[model samples]
Target: MTKPDLAKRPDDVSSMFDRVSRGYDLTNDVLSLGVTPYWRMRARRAIDPHPGQQVLDVACGTGTVTRILADHGSTVTGLDFSHGMIEEAIKRHGDHPNITFQQGDATQLPFDDNTFDVTTVSFGIRNVQEPKRALAEMLRVTKPGGKILVCEFSHPTNGLVNFGYDTYMNVLMPGIVKLVSSDPEAYDYLFNTIQAWPEQATFASWLREVGYEQVAHRNLTYGIVALHRGTKPAA
Candidate 1:
């Protein structure tokens, strides 16, 4: 598989995701030691989707978080830039009455402003070509006073844990990916992005700059992953 230029070219990133869509979730589960479900649960709780709420799950690969939102009684639209990912999502959750999937870019969402009660992206922001624009789009689409949840990998706070985490991410993860992932080299890029991402505080500031109010982040798994939450100010 051809590797995408992670620094530029959004279409390349989309194509990369398409190539890896078949084993993406399984690769995540394997690398994270099956802990991704727990992380998704935490993200769902942060958003607290309820009956009658309309949600947009941006970068909703394979509909994991989308299914969670729908199960909690919200009407959800799972959107991703990768067509293959959307195809898999629909195949898995098409029978569900409350959820729909679409192919879309986070930086240029295909919806009117203030359309959703909540907007979220899971483990996906770092992959976007323009993360700030994506955040702005997420803010624009969400209802005033509604929530925006971002779940992504973060630097661990504990020194000992950080050492372990770094070792796993830098070394063990790639080895594991080689055995399981459809595109093992992509994990190299994943490792680099995870390491390069801003910490909890810096990311919270980004949310605020994007016009989200009361922005905050909660560290999970000893800060290995974080769930950031913010509210869009009411008009």
Candidate 2:
């Protein structure tokens, strides 16, 4: 039941993810109330992966979104800080010719500058100790004019929906996680982080501040989740 604190120390967060890797995907599916697939679909659509593109899926737990990008014809690399998560990803997707998994840090990506046509992270950026550093790294790796997308839990815009979502996260989700998650304390960390995360507009501003252009966000499920996109300046 290891759990990372709000400060999000890299070692503790990585170990926490490792502890939950065995049932990570399943638990996420359950916790997301079966909307995980829809979220992935929205993310894929936003990315619009195609042949001849080099796509990087950062913190790609279990390689789920990475596999989707590969299916759409991109050569995809799924990178995660958690070795256990990377192991699970390889176990599930090693046979895919278009996909590769690597264990790496987000703040300092392993690849060279201008290496990827598109870089994305879904439900992972918030776990980074310095989210802006990761965003900058993603920008550095992306080709000029390339795309960057992040899909994460976000604050709801509508007051009524916000209240309901808050109620669910603060009240209902704890009991549900205790029942289904192997490491319930990890999910407790998840809840806390989600609660503390910046809103969609604020996070989009972070992307802009990190040198991404054309930054925008689309709210989903009444803003319980937000998909943010940006482009590396061509010049």
Candidate 3:
């Protein structure tokens, strides 16, 4: 299926993900050189979820992050705008006792204010139509003093690393995707979005603008990806 240029069309992004849902995980693993698991582990540790806490994993593609949170004893709600992705997530982890999957938008979350102890989005925030609105919604739905974490691709600080990463994303990634991905164009869209996303420092500033405190980011893999965390200010 020919997908709209997702960077321009916010509504089309979900459908693009839906079409790629079946092979998403496998293609991602291949393209990331099997390092995504390491990234997710670092992101999970950043959250440090506790038993009995209510957590929301926004844009929780295929439940990878959701499962991590649930495994740590948090009552996790995995929310994604893509129904196909949600279906895949349920099929993979439905039997997990603490995880529930929901189809919902990031910019306009379907939850009450202050409903969760932690709100997280992994590699999904950049796809949102209005990231600031999404961040505000994350803050609104999280309890005061609760944490918000965003894990997303970022620019590499090292010149050589940046050049190599750019070549991989622009040149080699598409070839690998064509071999393994159901929708190869989706990977092209992925590369475009990653290129367009803000760097670590700018994203941390966005977190603070949305009323989060202690906004900070930890770069992983030489700044190829960043894990950002902030706390909803206690009133």
RMSD (CA, Å), each prediction: 1.2, 1.1, 1.3
lDDT of 3 at 157: 90
Give candidate 3's total backbone clashes. Answer: 0
Better of 2 and 3 by TM-score: 2
Candidate 1 regions off by >4 Å? Answer: none
Mind giving the per-residue lDDT tens digits that candidate 3 earns over 1-235? 3475644465688888888898888888999999999999999999887798999999998998999899999999999999899999999998899999999998899999999999999999988888999999999999999999899999899999999998888788888888998777787788888888988988988898989999988889999999999999896
Model 3 clashing residue pairs (backbone)? none
Expressed as tens digits, the lDDT of each residue in 1-235 for candidate 1 is 3466558467777887888888888888988999999998899888888999999999998898999999999999999999989998998897899998999899999999999989999999988888999999999999998989999999899999999988887778777888998787778888888888999999999999989999989999999999999999999
TM-score of each: 0.97, 0.98, 0.96
Give me the runs in candidate 3 sitting further than 4 Å from their true place: 6-8
Clash pairs (backbone) in predicted model 1: none
> Model 2, range 1-235, lDDT digits (tens) per residue?
3359899999999999888998998989998889999999999999999999999999998899999999999999999999999999999998999998999999999999999999999999999999999999999999999999999999889999988888888899999999999888898899999989998889988999999999999999989999999999996
